[model samples]
Every structure is written in C-alpha cells, then in structure tokens.
Target chain A: MSNLVQTITQSRIWRSFFRHGWPDNPLDRSLVMTSNIFFHLHPVKVNRKSLRATYTFGLGVMAVILFLELTLTGMLLMFYYAPTVERAYTNIVALQTQTPYGQLLRNLHRWGAHLMVLVVVLHMARVFYTGAYKPPREFNWVLGVGLLLLTLGASFTGYLLPWDQLSFWAITVGTSVAGYAPVLGSTAKAYLLGGPEVGQEALTRFYALHVMLIPLGIALITSVHIWRVRKDGGLAANDDR
Target chain B: MTNIPTRTPFSKSSGKTYTLVELVHRAPAQMIDHGPENTVFAFPVVALLELLLTLSVSAVLLFMSLTINAPLEEIANPNQTTDPAKAPWYFMGLQEMLEHGHPTLMAVVIPTILVLFTLAIPYIDNDRQGSGRWFTSERGKRIARNTAIYALLVMPAFILLDNSFPPRELLRGVVPDFVAQTLIPGTIMAAIVIAPLLVLRRSKPNAREVVLTLFTLMFVSAIVFTLTGFLFRGPGFELYWPWNMPDGYNPFMNL
Candidate 1:
C-alpha cells in the first residue's frame, strides 16, 4: 500500500496536481497551506490557545458551513422554482411533494438560512465578549458586521421566494419598515418591492438578489473576512498568553 | 562619484576563499518579556478540527431538517393579512420595537444607531490590553453579568409596562404626538441603555469594562425584544404566553 501511494505521488500528473509532497514534514505542510487556495485562509501555525473549543465555540466556522449548505441546497431548489406570483407558491408545493428529496432540499435550505443568521449573531457576540475585535482586527470585525448584514439580506430575500402567505405578509411587513425611513424610505421600499406591494415584479427582484447579488456579495466578503483573519495574526487568542 | 568596494567570497590577490566579517556582537533571537511559543501546525490539526466541525454541524442540520419541516402556509393574499404580520424571525426584534414607538424611531433610527455603534465598538475601545481574554478581566465579567441581569429584569419590565400603557395611545390627547410617540419611549429606552454606564463611571471603568456593560445591555435587550416579538406575540400582534397564543398561531411557523 505504501509503495502504491509513493508511486502515484511520484508520478508527474500527481506532482502537478499537488505542488507539495505528502504533508508529513514541516516544509511540505507549510507548502500545503501556502499552495492551496482553500487552506491558504489559515496560517502555517496557530496558537494553541485559539484552538480551545470554549474560546470560540466554533460559531464562525459553523456559519460558513451553513452558508455552503445553503448555497448548495439553494441551487438545487432553484432547479424546481420559478419566481412568479402565480407559480411560485405552486412550485414550492411541487418541490415539497412532487420532486424527489425536494422536500428535504427545501427544508435544509430553509433551516440553514435561519441557522446561518443565528450562528452569525452568536459569532459576533463571541468576538465582542472575547475582545477579538481589538486592534488590527477592528476592520475584520467591521467586515464581519457587513457579512452579517449580507447574511440577513440573503435570508430575507430568500424568504419571499416561497411565495406563501407567510412569506407574502412577512415581506410586506418587512419592507414597510424600510418605508419608515425619513426621506429615502419610500424609494427604498419601492426599489425593493419593484412597486408599492409584493407582486411579480417584487418576486423577480428578490429572485435576482437571493440567487445572485447577495450570495455573490457574501462569497466575496467572506473571503476577505477569512483572509483578514490570517493577516491579522490568526485568532486574537494568540495574544492571551 | 567613486564606487565603494563590495565584499566578495574570493580574494583577488590570494586567489583563495575569503569571508566578509563583522566585529560587533548581535543580540540573540530570544528576548525578555516574550512568553514561550505554544503553537501547532494548521495543516493537520486545524484542518481536522474544521472537518470535524463541518461534519457535526451538517449532521445536526440534517437531523433538524428531517424532523421539523420548514413551514409553508396558504397562498399569498393581499386582502387578508396574517394576524401579526411579523417579519422574519431575525427581524422580529425590530418589529417588536415598532410596537413600542413611532416606526421611524423604533424601526429605523434606533436600529441604525445600534448598528453603527456596534461597528464602532472596536474603534471606541481601542486599548490592546486584553485582546483575547473573555470579558477582558474579572471586573469586566462582573460588569457584563450584572449588566445582563439588569437588562434581563429591566427590558421585560419595560416591554410589559410599555405594552400595558403605551404612551403612544395613553398620552395621545394628553401630550403632543412627538412627545408621546417619540420622546417618551425614546427617553425611556435611552435611560435603560445608559443607566449601567452611568453607574460604571463612579468606578472609573476602563474602555473594555464600559464596552462590556453596553454590549451586554444591547445584546440581552435584543434577546428580550426578539423573544417577545417572536414567541410571545400572538393574534393581533398582541403579547401573550407562547403556549397560549390565540387562533393556533404558532410563532415557530413564522420561521
């Protein structure tokens, strides 16, 4: 088994695929992080203190995981959904009852949206309580707040996609709150709903935001948020001891 | 300008290996006041931990998705509004706030100010003394706990009191609209938020302590408002016990 693994690793194709050798040695391990895009968000070394489960409760990472889950399930849901006042509700019914595992898909997306909002809030609380937002990380915290808002946006836009009475009324109420703003209120509400009320135009706009605009913003901002973590010296816990 | 001689590995005259030397003694790599380096490579350890977290979170989400299906109510009807007509669960806090005062103040102004204040916290408390420590110190933790307790008691009381005798309604003819709707409720909320900071001023609290007090107040108050708006509000958007919600209106369905 070892020989087979070595042979494959030594092959040109495998070497080209992974620039580093097996990550058993220090040099290869460092290369593994620096060379890979996904792993590059992390530093080559992390302080032992930061790894404690109690310190972070892993809420930030859980938020990211939930985001990925939402993205996947959301894409699948899109395959069965259409953003129209007439068909949106029926499409949801069909998704739940007709499509295979469609109910589970919608369920995961729905629950994940709620969970992401929750975990992001908890993560912010954890950061604040731990003082992780202190110097050099202050901007990261700001970005995180931006990300939190984006998460809310993503979830809110998705909320109207179901087109049921729950979504319709919830959105009507939500957007009306925006209309309470002083000068730009009505304009913002009209822009959001594509009119004075939730209708086909609102559905189209929300669909665009839920699937494209907000998720893209989240993806881009999340990258910056994690990259800033590495640049700002891993976790704030590194300064504890 | 004349060029300065650059050091070389080999000497021209001797045609032999040469060296560039310095006479000064440099400081060693170690330094005082620096603690022992305690760290681990991120590749295996962090990667493994993240993998474990992802799997566990996914499992929990899957279990939840399987057991409790997401709510899908009747078709959209513009003419017939839901009893409460609440926002998404996350925005329920803001909606609840709207019940207390004018929509502009309760929904827009206060929430906007809170968001801006939250974003400004790190800048406001820029001292680097206790970056990683939970609640900064013993005093900070005590302040946070007390502030939380205070908010826990005060916010619910405020909610219930304000609900029972809403200034917006009770003082409608007694006082000006601005005073009744905006000023009264606004002043009360400001007092609730600022009372702890006023108390902390006597002790000459550090920036961290002050932030702890303020954040705890805000965080706990948000919880109170959200819980009230979500679980407690029932038909006609009126406050009620969660289990006793009228017309079979389950708040969880709003999720």
Candidate 2:
C-alpha cells in the first residue's frame, strides 16, 4: 500500500495537480495552505484562541456558506426564471408546481437569504461586544458594516423578483423609505425603481440587481473583507492575553 | 533541526560567512506586550472546521427548505395592495419607526444616524486596552446589561405611548407640521439615546464603557422595533399582539 501511494504521489500528474506532496508533515502542510486558492485566505498558522467556537460562534463562516448556497440555488433558479412581468409570476408558479425539486430550491434561497441577514447581524454584534473593532481592526469593522448593508441589499432586491402582490407591495413600501430622504429622495427612488412606480421597469431593474449587480458587489467586497481579516492579523481574539 | 545551517546557503559562494542573530527591541511596542505564542497549523484543522460548518449550515437549510415553503402570493398587481404591507423583515425596524413620527425622521434620518454611529464606533472607542474580550470587564458587562434592560423597558413604553397619543396626530392642528412631526419626536428619540450616556458620564466612563452603553441601547431598541413591526403590527399597520393580530394577518407569510 505504501509503495503504491508513493508511486502515485511521485507521478508528474499528481505533482502537477497539487503543488505540494502529502500534507502529513510540516512543510507539506504549510505548502498545502499557501499554494491553494481557497486555503490561501488563511494563514499557515492560526492562533488557537481565535479557533474557539464560543469566541465567534462561527457566524462569519455560516454567512459565507449561506451566500454560496444562495448563489448555487439562485443560478439554478435563473435557468428557469424570466425577469419579464408576463413570465415572472408564471415562472415562479411553474417552479413551485411543475419543476422537479423546484419548490425546495426556492425555499432554500428564500430562507437562506433571511438566515444570512440574521447571521450577519449577529456577527456584527459579536464583533462589537468582543471589542474586535478596536484599533487595528477598526476599518475591518467598517468593511463588515458595509457587507451587512450589501447583504440587506441582496435580500431586498431579491425580494422583488417573484413579482407577486407580496413582492410588489413590500418593495413599494421599502423604496418609499428611500424616497423619504430630503433632497435626493425621489431621484434615488426613481433610479432604483427605474420609473415612478413598481412596474415592468422596476421589475427589470430589480431582476438585474438581484441576479447580477448586488451579488457581484457582494462577491468582490467579501473577498476584500476576508483578505483584510488576514491582513489585520487574524481575529482580535489572538490579541487577548 | 539543529543540523540546519543558520546562514544562507549562498554564503559559501559569496566567500563571506554570515551568522543569524536575534535583534532585541530598545523600546516597548504594541507587539511586545503579547502573551505566549499559542497557535496551530491552519491547513487541515481550519479547513476541516470550515467544511464541517458548511455541511451543517447547508444541512440545516436543507431541512428548513424541505419543511417550509417560501411564500408566494397572487401575481404582481400594483392595483391590489396587501393590507398592512411591509418591507422585508430586517427593515421592519424602520417601518415600525415610521409609525412613531415623520417618514423623513423615522425612516431616513434616524436610520442614517444609526448606520453612521455603527460605522463610527471603533473610531470613537479606539483604545486597545481590552481588545478581544467580551464587554471588556465585569463593569462593562454590567453597564451593557443594564443599558439593554433600560432600553427594553423604555423603547416599548415610548412605542406604546407614541402610538396611543402620537404627537404627530394630537398636535397636528395646534403646532406647525415640522415641529409636531419632526422636531418633537426627534428630540424625544435623541433624549432616549443620550440619557444613558449622561448617566454613564457621572462615573467618568472610558471610551469602551460609553460605547457599550450606547450600542446596547441601539441594539436592544432595534430588536424591540423589529419585533414590534414584524410580528405585532396587524391590518392598517396598527399595533397588536403577535398572537392576536386582526384579520388573520400572519407576518411570517410576508417573509
């Protein structure tokens, strides 16, 4: 068995696939992290204090997981959905009734959106209460706040996609809040709705935002947010005495 | 490990011997005060932990998706509005605030201020003395707990009081619209937020303590308003018990 494993690992194909050998030893373990795309977000070594489950309750990880789930399910949904007013509602009805596991897909995306918002809020609270936002991490906290708003944006824009009475009225109320802003209110509302009210223009604009613009912004910002975590010396828990 | 050379391998080629030496700091710095080095390799451990989290979160989501259906009402009809129409659940706090005063003040101005305050917290409390600790100290925890309880009591009372005898409604004919709608409610809301800071000031609280008091107030008040709007408000957007909402209006369906 050992000889076979060695032969396989020593092969050029295996070496080309993985830049590092088996990660059973220190050098290989470090190489496995540094050379990989996903694991590269992490440092070669992490402070043991930061790994405590109670410290973070893994809310940040959960938020990212939920985002990935949304992306996957959302893409699958896009394959069947048409953003047009004539087809949007029918698409959702067909998804719920006709398509295979379609209701489940919509369910996951919907509940996942709500859960992500809740998790992000709790993560912010955790960071604030832990004093993780102090000093060197102050800007990271700002980034976190920005991410929270984006999360909310993603959820809110997606809320309008079903093109139901619920989505229509909910958005009408939501955007009217933006219209309450003094000078720039109406312009912002018009820009968001793409018209004076919730119609085809609003539906089209929200669909583009829900499926593209907001998610792209979130993806870009989340990369920066995670990178900043490493740049700022891992979690603030490491600084605890 | 000791067999490893302390100098670079190229030293022999350059015909100059080099020795590794530890440089000591002459003055104290931020990095000097840290505790013992307690760390582990991130590769397998963190990777495994993340995988576990991903699976568990996905599993939980799967269970929820399998059990409950996401709400889908009739097709989009701008002509027909849902009674007690609401924003998304997270924005219910702002919607609840709208019931208290003017839209500009409740929805736009106050929300903007809260976001700004949240962003400004770390800068305002820039001290590094208690980073990574929950609530910093026992005193800090007590302050947070008390402030939270105070907000829990005060915010609901303000909501009920404002709802029953809304200054915006009662003083509408007597006072100017701006004074009745914006100025009075704004002052009351500001007082509610600032009163705790004033009490904390008597003790000459540090930056962290002050932040704790303010954040607790804001956080708990947000919960109160969100719960109020999301669960309690019924038809015509009037306040009702979550269990006893009129017209069979189930807020969960709005999610």
Candidate 3:
C-alpha cells in the first residue's frame, strides 16, 4: 500500500490523467481527451472528399473562430466604448491611443465582421457544391442559411455602434434599403431607426440588436446547426466509394 | 486440343476455385463500412490541430480588437446624406441592379425568387444520387456549377453599376421612372441572362457546357456593364472607389 501511494505521488500521474489517459499510449490519451465534454467541439473524424470542397474549405471554421474572437473583444471593448456619438469617436480614439492594444481590438472586430460575411457566403457555396443540401441534411442547410443572415445582422448592428460618418450613412443606406419594402419602406425606416434619421434612438436600437437580439438568434441557430450536423448522421457520406 | 492445353488446369482436382456465390456479395472490397473504421481521426495529431486553430483565430482577433478601434464619427445627420449612399459591399451587387432599374426588381423580386428557389431545390429533385461529387448524376452538377460561375462574375459588375446609381436627391429630381425600373432591369436581364440561356438551349449544348458558356457570358457582361458605367459617369462621379470614399469628393453635394 505504501509503495502504491508512493508511486501515485511520484509519478505525476494526475497531470497526465487530466490531459491524457492513464494508459500512456498517445491514441488512448487522445480518445480520453476527446471524450471529455470540455474538449469535444471537434469531431473524431472528417470526410476527406468533402474536405477539399473549394467553396469554403477552411474558411467557415476560420470565420467561426473569428466570431468567438469578436465576442471576447467586443466584451472588452464594451468596458471602454460609449454608445453616444459625441463620446463614441473620442472613446475609439482613446481606445486606440490610451488603452493597450486597443487599436488591434478595433481592427480585429472590423476585419472579423467583414471576414465573417465572406466566410458565410463561402460556407453556403461549399454546402451547395457538396450537395450537402440533400434530404436529411436539408433542414440544417436552411438553418445554416439563417445563421449566415444572422451573422450579417450582427455585422450590420456592430457597424452602427461606432457612429462614424462612414458607419452612420452606411447604416442609413442599409436602413433605407430596408425601407424599400413597399408600404413598409417609410414606416419601417421610422421603426428601424426608432425615429426619422439615425440619431440617439437609432444607436440605442442598434445597440440592443447587436448585444441582445442578434447574438441570441445566433446562439439559438448555432445550437440547432450543431445538433442537426450530428443528427444527420455524422459527416456527409461519399457516394463514390 | 488446337489451343494445346495452355493452362496447367489443376483447379478441379485441388478444389482451388470458389463458388459463384463466394465471388459476389462476399467480396471484402465491395462491403459497406460502418462506424469508425479510421483510427487516424482518433489520433492525437488532428485533435490537437483543431484546438490550436480555434484558439489562434480567437486570440488574434482579441489582440487586434484591443489594439485597434472600430469606426465612429460625429453623429447621425438626417439633414446630410453621405455621397453614394452606398449599401454594404455585400449588397453592392443588388445596388448595381437598382441602377439598371428600380429597387423592386433587384432587391425584392429577384432576391425573393432566388431564396425561394434555393429553398425549393431539395423538394424539386427527389433523386438522392449525387451527394459528394459534382456530377451526382449528370444534369445536376452542370446546373450547379454554371449557376455558381454566372453569379460570381456578373455579381461584381452589377455591384459596380449600382455604385453609379444616383442618390435619392438625384432620383427625386431628375431620372425618369420608366428608366429606373423597367428599362434597366429588363435590358440587362435580357442581354445577360435570358439571351445567353436561349442561345445555349438553342445550340442544344450539354448542360455542363452550357453552364460553362453562361459563366463565360456572365464574365463578359460584367466587363461591359462596368465599362459602360465607367464611361457614363454622369454627375455621380463622386461615388468611385477606394470602395469606402474618394478624396476631395463631397457626398453632401447631392443633399
């Protein structure tokens, strides 16, 4: 018993146990690690044929990583960023100059948003090319399409938060585009902006949308997307073999 | 005996040959693979890789956001509209269409049709043959690739043309209604979409070949459309790129 206790204490087994399985074989350890919920976001296998589909290839996953980055950076930014247009630009300037690595945060958010839009389009194209939109996978594809739009919505809402001349009218143009919905055009613009012309109300509306409504939508649909990918029976199978 | 017994035929005596049934379904090569036959996927290398990738992008973005700032400006100005009054770059394609006509066809009508068509594809084709390869059967792959190529090439020029559309002030003041909606969409659709499709069908080309031709036509159409827009700048000369804004160009000129 003493020997066993001494072995347990001397072996550094606990550290390895957490990171890898006790058996000490690399494959065994990998299996154990992957089975753990904290590490299982990745699948144990991937389909090689569908793997190289050019429409997206690595881009979809890249975008998702960017979104995760956005969430974190956006949170950090929220600590410093003021929504008012008067303070907004100044805050951005402060973030860039005063805060450590603030400019990097801003760039990441900006570029990430743009990249996400591109990635979503590519993801859709990949899905289309691979014919992953067929049958059991159909509902998931539609859900993916929704997620794409939601990502776009997130980008749009985030754009308005800055209140720059470029951001402002870009959003205004976007809202006006929304207003083109026949009878809803005028009223919708009013509703969307929360009044005529983008002002304080528009900022607040966009803030709520960026932080609350759209993120929630993304989370909900993302959950459904993952579940569907699994429920549709792992990765899409190849008909060729 | 003319063949002179070319083979050393010992199979009947030794019973070396298998039955016909043994040669068919029992073949290991043709069997279905169920479950995780791949240990490589279960390997440590890929498991570490995905984690690394996910972590890196997130970390880099975090570093960037903290260092850089997102855009901000003075505030909203209803009295002042920006020059170009541009949509997001993604929507630039539709905007280009708006110049050819009005908002109705490009924004509402066409987008709705495309979305509906996208949604309807699985239902429209009951065949479950093509899942991984381009030509699941033969016809489907052709249509898919052609459509993709067409969308890719035509889309950019369409956006450029949209970049040239007059702002609301210009619209409210000068351009005719007939010119805005009907003439532009109608003409462009005919020249780029309908005419090419008609030509392909008339030639009785293979579906894949036709789609390829269509994409080619699409590419040509974009070049022509963009060039025409460039040549006819009219008063909207301020809306050219650097995509975001141009130097010395006053957007408020329209307002």
Best of the candidates, DockQ: 2
Instruction: Report the error of model 1 at residue A33, Å.
Output: 1.0
TM-score of each: 0.93, 0.94, 0.72
Query: Which residue ranges in model 2 land beyond 4 Å of their true spot?
Result: B1-36
User: Candidate 1 on B1-255: residue-level lDDT in tens?
Assistant: 124345454444433345554433232211123343687888899999999999999999999999999999999999998888989988999999998999999999999999999999999998766888898888888999999999999999999999889889988799899999999989998988878888999999988888888889999999999999999999988889999988888899888
lDDT of 2 by residue, B17-41 (tens): 5644445453322345553368788
lDDT of 1 by residue, A1-96 (tens): 999999998999999889998899999999999999889888887778899999999999999999998999988888888898889999999989
The better candidate by lDDT, 1 or 2, is 2
CAPRI docking class of candidate 3: acceptable
- Residue clash pairs of candidate 1: none
Candidate 1 regions exceeding 4 Å error are B1-36
The model with the greater DockQ, 1 or 3, is 1
lDDT of 3: 0.61
Model 2 TM-score is 0.94
1 versus 2: better DockQ goes to: 2
